[model samples]
Target: MALVETATFECGGCGTCAPSTWIDYDRLLYPVCPEYGRATGPLA
Candidate 1:
């Protein structure tokens, strides 16, 4: 089984400053922010 880990960060885009979650896997970083509304891309 593979291990999973997560981290929280602050979003400094869109002037909202919402909180974001990041998952760490295989040395890769995946960020999730509410400002992006479930999109996998960066905030506009």
Candidate 2:
């Protein structure tokens, strides 16, 4: 299984992190990059 890591963000008190597209929530949900998902090695 992929060992997922968390991302930190600079938010505008909004429910999102721009560019990275990571959501701002009371509890976080990680958004994997499309390229990262396509990678088929250790993280696959």
Clashes of each: 0, 0
- Any residue pairs clashing in model 1, and if so which? none
Model 2 residue 12 CA deviation in Å: 3.3
Q: Which ranges in model 1 have alpha carbons more than 4 Å from their true place?
A: 1-8, 15-27, 37-44
lDDT of each: 0.41, 0.37
Question: How good is model 1 by TM-score?
Answer: 0.23
Best by lDDT: 1
Clashing pairs in 2: none
lDDT of model 1 at position 24: 23
lDDT of 2 by residue, 1-44 (tens): 99976665434333333354443222234343343232222322
Candidate 2 lDDT (Cα, 0 to 1) = 0.37
Deviation from native of the Cα of residue 28 in model 1, angstroms: 3.6
Worst 10 residues of 2 by lDDT: 35-44
